[model samples]
Target: MMLDSETTKTYTRPISKAWWLRDRGHFNRRYFMFLLRELTSVFVALYVVLFIYEIFLLTKGPDAHTAFRESLSAGPWIAFHIIALLFALYHSYTWLGLTTKMQAAGRGLVKIGTKTLPPILIALGSYGAWIIATCIIAYLFLTL
Candidate 1:
């Protein structure tokens, strides 16, 4: 049996348009940085959507795609890209740092004889892998 609408109560909480920014009047540097780090995904998602739209424009012909590409080369787009890059880098760095912490916590799973590798080494290895992957993608793009 379904409950009657009259008996079922609904509650609503008023939320501010800038709710996320409401309590930032006294946030420490680290807390502010954490907020910025979390915001990185918004920029990253915007960039990805932009990239996909550019690819879609390619199907419209070279003229359409070239015009779109030239438009993106403008100052505003360039600045946006630079800011997005910085945010993306921050996001990646934080994620890699977390990875290092996880590895440190799971030291027993990756022991060499009787000693476990240091967290710094684990972080470095993760960063190295990221760099290598980036280089490979760049190389492929340049060559193709």
Candidate 2:
């Protein structure tokens, strides 16, 4: 007797345990960059957790907080922060590029007066705002 198509079991190929690293040697620059971009989240999450822990230490008193800060000044932690900063900047740049692409793709949805705004202009505006905000925060942090 022939089984109906609906009753047939379909088999899927099993994925290799090391599938993600299978072609590490042959990946193009874009592929590597994409992987690095994803890796940035781990650093970002780590930094956030460290920041929260520092805040918690603050409640324990000045000595605890000072000790924590001193610990972070060690060589390994300094290197980690430097690496994390680089990755964070890379991630931010990629995100901004994506935002530009999305805005360009949707330009027709929002017209300004007689024309759509340029994508580069939008990107520059975003970068400009980021710079301004950073400067303001830095100034406040330094002065107050």
Candidate 3:
């Protein structure tokens, strides 16, 4: 059975454009961090775009690629890279920790046999794997 539209009216609360910024008490450190985490994606996307552009520049011959390389070697470019690296690191850290949060939420993302693994263990495993991979890559890069 369908209810009458007049009798079953729903109220939609009016929210400000800067709702996130408006609520100082409700939007605490966690909310700010969440926003920061989201902002990290912009830097990551920018770096990916730059990398693709560099690859495209390579196809345009040595002179174009050399100019791009020279521009990247400048102070401002170096600072941008450093900032991007920090944001990228933060993004990666938060991403890897998400598994632990999910597991801890009792969703059973990490389970062994009938028993569910602890959140800390899940976090450790992810971070450990990341460290191992980084070490291997670093080793290869240094050697080759």
Indicate the residue-level lDDT of 37 in model 3. 96
The lowest-lDDT stretch of 10 consecutive residues in candidate 1 is 18-27
Ordered list by TM-score, greatest first: 3, 2, 1
**Cα RMSD for candidates in order:** 6.0, 5.4, 4.0
Q: Each model's TM-score, in the order given? A: 0.77, 0.78, 0.82
For every model shown, the clashing-pair count is: 0, 0, 0
Highest lDDT: give the candidate number.
Answer: 3
> Candidate 1: lDDT of 93?
90
Alpha-carbon lDDT of model 3: 0.88
Q: Is candidate 1 or candidate 2 better by TM-score?
A: 2
Q: Which of the predicted structures, 2 or 3, would earn the higher lDDT when compared with the native? A: 3
In model 2, where do residues sit more than 4 Å from their true spots? 1-25, 106-110
Runs in model 1 deviating more than 4 A are: 1-25, 105-109
RMSD in angstroms, candidate 3? 4.0
80-110: candidate 3 lDDT, tens digit per residue? 9999999999998999988989999965686
lDDT of 2 by residue, 40-73 (tens): 9998999999999999998999999999999999
Candidate with the larger lDDT of 1 and 2? 1
Q: TM-score: which candidate is best?
A: 3
lDDT, candidate 1, 29-123, per-residue tens:
66567789899999999999999999999899999999998998999999999999999999989887787888778553456889887877888
